[model samples]
Target: MLSVDNLVASYNAGPVLQGVSLSVQAGEVVALLGRNGVGKSTLLRTLVGLVPSWNGSIRIDGTPLAPIATHDIARMGMALVPQGRGIIGKLSVADNLRAAMRAAGSRPALSIDQAIAPFPALREKLPAMAGTLSGGQQQQLAIARAMVGRPKVLLLDEPSEGVQPNIVQQIGQLVRKLADESGLAILIVEQNLELALATANRCIVMAKGRIVHSGPPDEFRNEAVLRRHLAL
Candidate 1:
């Protein structure tokens, strides 16, 4: 479980997240949607402690996380697969996965085979250099790396970006499986509305650093609601 209460953050330009609030429960998947510069990504960064919160609180399983170190946050049962698929290009696929398992500390490490089970393509590319893989493969590696951490809450920032349509669909299925089977609470920041709606059980739309709308995926069926909040 995760809770963000009136969360606020700012960059050099000015405040980017202002009094944003939301929550995710175990086995639940929530989609964060908005136009450019609406603080969707900043919220994820703040949750992971990559960006400091200016105000408000972030709690995991009822434990406050805002003042903790980024690594400490990860150790507390949260993992982030960032937008760019931050894989270690020089490392082999297997090595990348192994490194993440080690970083998970006391949590049970997912074996290489188990980690790549959802991503069969990664099985054959175990010895290949991560940088040598296509964007989609690299994305799979990113998610696989996070999976090895055995996180209670997974924060995904634009998992579908730069991925092909087929791969995007696979990513959605994988997310659903993770939540349904693993009971992992997930928050996905996505520009791809279709993927967001397809994967998330509920949707939250943000604007100018605050949440303006929250509802089930079916809310998108109303053209006015979709356009008013997401400008879709």
Candidate 2:
């Protein structure tokens, strides 16, 4: 569903992703794993055009995406739930979901009620201000908001970070459901190895801004592979 070839990207100081390449098939979940500051998030941002690629090509479906703006990328069926949840703090839960739907430029296949079904806590809080929610609740809101867009490929950056264990597990289950039932291709950047293994069908490990390992989830369970590419 998505393919990236020899992707390179950088900020003012220097490059953060160098010659990275990967692909996500339809209805598959791919986990992007790495220790802190290894450019996992940068690669996602570059793919969706939030950060411009210095070199390389990114294609969604069969069309090149390198020239599109980030908003255009969303219209092309990609949704990003960034690291911080990126929720509009002052907006009500319903408004947040509505905004995402509007931004995507189409009615979501999953309605707001259905999107929040997996997150029961969020359902009761739809009228509440997003800023008033706890970290876990906000994370749920973020995921729900993304679901409201009905993206073909969902890019999630550390959805488990700062969330409670129970909520994290719930999020993992939702990720699997999205891939299995809804046929959404998921690319998640996660530091939580257990969550990644449980949620994603494949794993890509990065080090020093390059992919060091790319294989099925079981291949990443090897002690040697984890130590070499992701050990802190």
Worst 10 residues of 2 by lDDT: 102-111
What is the RMSD of candidate 2? 1.4
The most accurate candidate by lDDT is 1
- For the record, the alpha-carbon RMSD of candidate 1 to the native fold, in angstroms, is 1.0
Note the Cα lDDT for every prediction shown.
Answer: 0.91, 0.88
Structure candidate 2, residue pairs in collision: none
* TM-scores of all predicted structures: 0.97, 0.95
Give the per-residue lDDT digits (tens) of candidate 1, residues 1-232. Answer: 9999999898766889989989999999999988998888888889999998889999989999988999889887899999899999999999999989865769888999999998988899999999999999999999999989899999999998899999999999999889999999999998888899999999998999999889999888689988788777
lDDT of 2 by residue, 49-94 (tens): 8888888898878889888888988888888999999999999998
TM accuracy, model 1: 0.97
- Identify the runs in model 2 with alpha carbons over 4 angstroms from their true place: 106-110
For model 1, how many clashes? 0
What's model 2's TM-score? 0.95
